[model samples]
Target: MTDCDFLVVGHGLAGATLAYVLRQRGYRVLVFDPGQADSASNVAAGLINPVAGKRFALTWNANELLPAAASFYRELEQCFGQQFFFEAPIFKIFGSLDEQSALLTRSPDHPWGDYVASLATTDPGLPGVQAPLGGAWLRHGGHVLVRELLAALAAQGEREGWLWRETFDWTKLVTDPTGARYAGRVQARHVICCEGAAATQNPYFNWLPLTPNQGEVLDVECAGLSSAQVLNRGAYVVPVGGGRFRVGATYRWPPFADGPTETARQELSGRLAAITEQPFAVVGQRAGVRPAVRDRKPLLGPHPTVPSLSFGGGYGSKGVLLAPRLAGLLADWLEGKAELWPEVDLRRYAALYRPAAGS
Candidate 1:
């Protein structure tokens, strides 16, 4: 009945990446995804920024995650015969003297301080942009074409008979002492639920404290901007294709009504307008709920109750940079080789769950 060694739910970056890694390891993998509307990974700008504003701190695990991510995506490109990942510096514009001072103030103690260099006293070629106090330059940080990568992975999965295109039937799902089962049917040695925000619905893990963030982005045509470096001000204006750019994104927590709304669009548009003086046209507007957690860390590893079933999500805005590395760790843990990240391991939240009444 269509047996598979691994069955991964959700075809977003997390799911696709997990499946690809297992397949590379020579395991029989099957993916279940319905191509649902507006999964967070689909709407992500795929920016891998090292230094973030609002404290100018290095992203969590930026040093290790960045190199691992670069090597992983480059290898995937070679295997899939495609070019979607590009290495470009990110230019975070300083809006005022205070923000610039804040940046220089924290440079010494910051982990990513090495990548943080003051604007060279010479012309850097960036034009038509406001640089009040100039800004920091990050070397290893760059962008990945998320949509293209997803499309490639899906295509590759289809060709290899590793992908099953359909909504995951929870009723058909079963777990026991041996391992996880799909459709009350096909037995797999491992089953990972990379279902993004949908993890909040899983009875076994619902109480783990998932904070879904509703975010939106505006796709605009910003013609004549040649430099592909990600432009960041109040909001990030990331170039996508055909002189078009994806600008975003506003965050709303708990009580966050899912899906795109007019309110979000106006807020995002206003933020973009405030940052750039160049004429821009809004071509599209989209939104999705990111599966963020309270500690701002991703949730990975096995289910607290169901040992066989695992989860990999809650990456929030850093899904592009975080998922690949975490997916590899999941693979390692499943294969019994490596220890899971304590910050992401599900056991960290075990105190919240009551262990299903009794053992």
Candidate 2:
């Protein structure tokens, strides 16, 4: 049985990024992934929008996380010998004068205001496709080629003897006083679960408040679309490299078992058409569950009772923006070098459920 210092489950952005971070720290790591479950990271357009939506509120913790993510991805590029991050400005088009007024109104108090450039009074190059009442540019925001990055990391991990492509069977797991064992076989110093929404299935953390939401995105061919800038009107049109754009993200609370449905497709298409006059062909449709929490904060840190098990998830739609920082934070915490964020530390929640110390 192969033994390592660490074993991570799942290879989505969460797991993959964490594995990369741990490996960089000189930890002997083995990453296992089934590669079957629907992962939000795979289908994500990987947008990093500091300023977003009609309200245009800065994404939670954008100030602290954005720069950290940028630096992390750059270093990863150098390590992996590949580029997956692009610094692109988002074009937020105003559907009405009220929208423009809203942006101007909030620009001052909003922490992301300095990133927002002056509005363009005239419609730009994609006029045939979209009309602009005026739009602002968000600086220091861009997109990450999520799948490419994951694949690159996976490849690098493989070359470094750190990745295993297989489903993790919980039934085969065994634990003793010394350490935890997977399948009563491979032993590790610790096991960290990065299973995304699947973390809800783990018996230990299953009790954690998880409000998984289903989101869908349509990959369309936008041959003539100009610039890689993500277009924001009703739904976002994010460039996916190679002249393709991912337009979507329909949020369904209950979730559907059948995955993508005709109703959702029509709804997304209709929204895209409303935002742009251009005729685009739908080349692909993808759906996955966002591993969100009610408070919308990440869940990280070691297990409460299990000394050798750790967890890091709850990134939801912002996995691309949140994973790198959280990965570094997790690594630091594991190494006894840093403290976990109180907001994300699972111990904060455990205290409410589990009995108080010495009580």
* Per-residue alpha-carbon lDDT of candidate 2 for residues 54-88, written as tens digits (9 for 90 to 100): 67777878778899999988997888788888898
TM-score of each: 0.93, 0.92
lDDT of each: 0.80, 0.81
The Cα error of candidate 1 at residue 191, in Å, is 1.4
Q: Which residue pairs does candidate 1 place in steric collision? A: 172-184
**TM-score of predicted structure 1:** 0.93
Candidate achieving the largest TM-score: 1
The lDDT, on a scale of 0 to 1, for candidate 1 is 0.80
Best by lDDT: 2
Instruction: Give the local distance difference test score of model 2.
Output: 0.81
Candidate 2 lDDT for residue 64: 86
Model 2 / residue 223 / CA error / Å: 2.7
User: Could you give candidate 1's per-residue lDDT for residues 62-145 as a string of tens digits?
Assistant: 778899899989988898788877888788877777876766666667657566655532225575555556766777878888
